[model samples]
Target: MQRGKKKIKEWKLKDEDTRRQFEVKVQQKNNRNRGGWKQLSENVLEAAKEVCGESTGHRRRRRETWWWNEAVQRSLQEKKRAYKRWQRTQNEEYKREYKEKTRQAKREVARAKRLALENWSEELNSSEKQKEMFRIAKQMKRESKDVMGAKYIKDERGVIKINTEEILGRYVTLKTC
Candidate 1:
């Protein structure tokens, strides 16, 4: 039994070593075909040549005039003048439209206020009798019986009274008056 276990352990070790060797060989083959760092360096060199004009078949040229100097001054001044003129015209048009709109709005609000006042005055005059009837109806509805069968009463002089059945419905008026 011990000899059989030793044989088994040796077989496992061989299998592991063979697998590792195969993996290493495959990696080496892939690296060779892909040209890893050498291909990257070649591409970088070609890009540098193109950007620096070494591959364009022409010598590098120098600028004759500086961009921010006298060559651009006249054009810049002309642009500034045109911009100022445009701004003035726009402001004038905006002011005119704003004033007209504000005037129209004011007129509309004043007209609405006048109409509201006229309607209110007409309603007050036309409903005078109706209002008086409603007021009297409301006052009568509010009267109630309380302790000792007493009922609240009011007179034209603004005096109030509480009359009870025990007093034979006789009322004693109190001044508020």
Candidate 2:
């Protein structure tokens, strides 16, 4: 499928008529075929209207997930409302309160997400395949692999063994290889 929106009459013919021989013939043929101007203009207008309709039409629904539940959304909305309220009043107290609420709400959301991941990890710890997947996920979610001190690595000898290291070299190798 095409990446962006398609527009009518957007096919710009080659400028300066590179085909010197066929240019005059093409222009003459185009001029002679002028009877369809009324219908052509109407079609172009219709197309323009269609494009406008798409822009002004009912908004398309977004894909949502159960993970983005009501409580978090409500907290976010409340934070925004607090900020807006501060904006309206320009009161220092309101601004401070908004900042505090925002930090609290954000921390709450992050804590919830971390707790969910921990719960999932606990459940998946039973299976070897799941443990591997969890490890991969942990690696992917980490800000830096430098924090992975004395990490386990699958060696060239195909031995699942522990190897101690200060840093894990780089995540690029882990992702690519």
Candidate 3:
């Protein structure tokens, strides 16, 4: 279908004739299986594929966690191995090593993710296009759902007013209240 229009191309051959020819071709290909495939329409075929979540790519379902890269995966695998070794041996040395490795792996992953975020933030801050910064800010707002607002209360005059009094809470939490 072409853009800016809603026109379906007419089939050169009729649907019934096309299905009959397709059936004959299938029958010829598979001599043993006399019962050929059922008539397939474009709509039905697309619907089936949609329902089945069909994809040609072998890695179509690969986990798409961007922050979890090869380095993090390697570290995690190493940590797992260390944990297993410690579990099997029950040695103090192995246990200490495993704990150290686990901590290091966690720290490395955190540093990498933090660095990535900082790099992105820096790039957005330095970008000439204002739209990019706004977009990033919008995305951050969406991902960080922490509400920010001062608590409002009805005054003696029966008017809702923002409470400016000091509250026994963290700044972020106070604002949220």
Top-scoring candidate (lDDT): 3
Candidate 2 lDDT, 1-177, residue by residue in tens: 223443332222222342342345445545655557785565544544433322322245334332465667888888999999999999999999899889978887887687767765686756864867878789887856556464456655556544344124333356778
- Against the true structure, candidate 1 has what lDDT? 0.48
RMSD over all Cα atoms, model 2:
19.5
Per-residue alpha-carbon lDDT of candidate 1 for residues 1-177, written as tens digits (9 for 90 to 100): 112211111222234554465446445555555667777555444433333223222234323321233324444454455556656787776555555555555555566557656654565665774686578678777765343653565554545644454233333333221
Off by over 4 Å in 2: 1-67, 126-177
Model 1 pairs whose backbones collide: 158-177
Q: Pick the candidate with the highest TM-score.
A: 3
Clashing pairs in 3: none
Over 4 Å off, model 1 = 1-90, 126-177
Global Cα lDDT for candidate 3 = 0.61
Counting only residues 3 or more apart in sequence or on different chains, how many pairs clash (N, Cα, C under 3 Å) in candidate 2? 0
Q: Which stretches of candidate 3 lie over 4 Å from their true place?
A: 1-63, 125-177
TM-score of each: 0.22, 0.36, 0.39
Candidate 2 at 17: error in angstroms?
Answer: 66
**77, model 2: CA deviation in Å?**
1.2
Error of 1 at 91 (Å): 1.9
Candidate 3 has its poorest 10 consecutive residues by lDDT at 5-14
Residue 18 miss distance in model 2 (angstroms): 63
The predicted structure with the larger lDDT, 2 or 3, is 3
